[model samples]
Each structure stands twice: as C-alpha cells, then as structure tokens.
Target: MSTPAAPALDSLDLALLQALADHPRVGDLELSRLLSVARATVQGRLRRLGEAGVIRGWSPELSAAAAGFDVAAFVSLEIAQGALDTVRDELLAIPGVVEAFVTTGTSDVLCRIAAASHAGLQGVLLDLNRSTSVVRSTSVMVLSTLIEPRLLPLLATTAAGREARAPAYR
Candidate 1:
C-alpha cells in the first residue's frame, strides 16, 4: 500500500517550527514567549513534530571544507544490473562519500564526494572505477556553491499560505 500523507501544519505549527529553526538552541519557555504560546503548547508541539518525523534531529551541521575536505565532486555511476544494493554497501565504506542517490535517465547512482586534495579526489575516483559493479562513471568538480542549503524561506511561504486560507473568525 502507498504511504499515508503527513498531517497538514496550521499557522501555529508553522510559527513554532520557524521559531525553532531560527533559534535551534532556544528552550521551550523562550520559544513559548517568542510565539506568545503556552510552554506546554511548545513542548507538546515539539513532541508531536518529533514523533511525526518532521523534526529529524537537533545536530549541528558540519562543513566538509572546514574539516580538511576542500575538494567536492559529483560522481554518476552506471552499475551492473541488480547490483544497486551491493554498490550502496560498498559506497558506505568510502570515507569521502557524503551523499548518494539512485536516479533515473543516464546514471543509476549519483554521489557527492569530498576530499582533502586533487590527489585524494583522484584516489577516490580510482576506487570507484575499480568496483566490479560499476560499468561506467562520470564526474564534475564543484567550483563554488552559489546558494547555501536552506529551509526557512520555504517554511515561511508554507505558513503564509496556511494563514491566507484560514477563516476570519479563527
């Protein structure tokens, strides 16, 4: 069966999420004060959001470049038929591989890798090319990041839409 749809977020839920996003380290009391909601409401909403898988984690985001991995590249792999699981397992063993996805069209798998130097990047490429499951591969180095990863803007837009649809009395 297909998965059930996630419950829709009201304006208050959106506001709470925005508050948390802005101040990830802020406590429930502060959040309640900022949103003009009860502390219990903040706690209950956070609990519910966490339970629903909306709030995945509170971990700090790390920068690969700051950690000595200065070079980044996107590698697309064409794997042997029925070898996706095997390839996935093998990729997990590679330290430089940050993210990977099974995709459509020309490539079967797409991976983002980080390395300390061009030589290190070459070594990682050699490792991928050595894999028996990988039939072909293509890659491109990232020159610069134009936009940093973000979610607050999208959340704000969602909140605005929800508010616009609400009845005047509420």
Candidate 2:
C-alpha cells in the first residue's frame, strides 16, 4: 500500500524543522535543548514525523570527487511524444544516472549523471542517444557542484503542526 501523505505544520513545527535542518544528526536530547522543548516531546515528535514520512531518513553527505566520481553531467532529453514512461524507465535503469525528473520547456526530461571519467560519461551519452524513446539529447558537463541534496524547508514543521491537531493524536 502507498504511504499516507504528511500533514502541514505550524510555527513551533517550523522551529523544530529549522533545528533539525541545522543539525540532522543531533540526538533527541540535543534537539530538545536547541528547541527548548522537553526531551520526551522531541522523541515523540520525531517518531510521528518519521511515521508520517516527513523525515525520510538522515545520512552523512559524501563528496563524489573524493569518491572518484569527478565527472558530472546534466543531460536534457527530448522524448518522442507519449513515450515519457518508456524513456523515464530506461533512464532510471542506467547505472550512472543519479537523478532524473520530467520537466516542461525545451526538454521533456532532465537527468543528472555522474561518472569516474569523461569516457564513462561519453558511454552514458551514447546509450541515451540509442534509446528508442529519445529523439535528441544535450549534455552539459558540470564543472563543480555548488550545492547538493538537502531537506525541503518547513517539511518537518508542517508535519509537526498537523500532528498537533490530528484526530488520532487528540
């Protein structure tokens, strides 16, 4: 079954979200201290937040450059009309594709690919061009990454606010 969508948050929920944003790995006790709430409250809220899918999970950020995947490319694809599903599925199956999204404007899909070298990127580009659903593609190599993945602002706060008034909790 699909997970239920998370509810919205209020101001205090926003505060908690901001606190977590500052330190995702902080313990409940530390979070309580930072938010000036009870430790039990923090624990309970965290549990609810996780169950509601507001807090997906936490992990340390790793550098691709350090890991030897120095080459990055943003590839824009023009998919044949009504073939987005086939194209998206194929893109997802590609080994080097780190992210993919359907988009409006000039391109039907945008994909982020990372590889250990330029040769690896070239192979990915060639494979994309050969895909049956892809009409054309443009790849722009990334010189550097200014920002990586992070949580959406106010996600936790919105969840907290909704939990506060949820009938089940009440």
Candidate 3:
C-alpha cells in the first residue's frame, strides 16, 4: 500500500521542531514552557509529527570517526544488468558499508564506507570487488567534510515559505 502524505507543518509546528532540535532531551513540560504552549499542545503536535514520519527516531546521532572508524570513502559501483537487489543485499552484509544509494548516471550504486585504516578500507574494497553482481567499482577517499549532515535549515526554509536564507555555518 502507498504511504499517506505527511501533514503540512504550520508556524507553530516549525517553532516546536526548532525548539526540539535545539534541546532534544528536554521534557515536554519544558518545551511547552519554552514555546509558550500548553503541555497537551506540545504532546499532541509531537504525536502528529511522529505519526506523519517527520520525526523518524529519537536515538542520538553517532560519529564514525569518534567511534574509531577513521577512514571514509564514497564508492561508485557499476553492477550487472538488473542486479540491484542482489548487490544491495551483498552490500548490506558488509558492516563497513554504512550507506548506499541507487542512482541514475555513470554508476548504478553509490556507497559510503567507513574503516579503521587504509588497509581496512582496502579489505572492504576487496570484499566489494568479490561480489559477482558488481561489474566495476570506483572510489574516492574523503579528506575532510565541509558540511556535516543538516536538516534544520531546510525545515526552517520550508516553514518560512522558502523565503528565509539559511544561516551561515559556524
């Protein structure tokens, strides 16, 4: 079955999201006080957002680097014709393959991998190359990340009717 559309967020909803983003661990009572709304309102809005899939999870974000996976790379995979499902299953079996996307362009599958060292990365690459469904693979090591993953700016822009400029990163 197709998923239903997410509810359109209003100004108050945006404000509540921003407040929650700023203080993820704060209690609903505290959030109500900060947003100048009743506890019930906060609870209701949060419930709606969660039900609509706007809030996917409450887990703390973890860093691969801080977790001792010091090396990272983006691997572009050219897979055998109509082998996406098989290749995806193979990719998922490898722990070092952190993220993957099926794309439209020169390559079919794009993967972000994390490893403890260059040797470890090479081992992961070798494992990828062993997959029969993968026709070819190319990769580039990440020297540094200019911008970490962010969603608040896009949320703010949507909330402001796409008129507000995103703030400069510190």
TM-score of each candidate structure, all chains considered together: 0.90, 0.76, 0.90
Tell me which residue pairs clash in candidate 2: 8-158, 9-158, 13-157
lDDT ranking from best candidate downward: 3, 1, 2
Q: In candidate 1, which residue pairs get closer than 3 Å at backbone N, Cα or C atoms, i.e. clash?
A: none
Q: Model 3, 1-170: lDDT tens per residue?
A: 88979677777888898898889899999999999999999999999999999998899988999999989999999999999999989999999999999999999999999999999999999999999999999999999999998777777667677334446562
The regions of model 3 sitting more than 4 angstroms off are: 162-170
RMSD, each candidate, Å?
1.9, 4.9, 5.4
Off by over 4 Å in 2: 1-6, 149-170
Clashes of 2: 3
Model 2 lowest lDDT segment of ten: 150-159
By lDDT, who's the top model here?
3
Write the residue-wise lDDT of candidate 2 on 20-130 in tens digits: 877877888998898898999888887877888777778776677789988999999999999988987898788888889989999999999989999999999988998
Please list all clashing residue pairs in model 3, or write none if there are none.
none
The clash numbers for all candidates, in the given order, read: 0, 3, 0
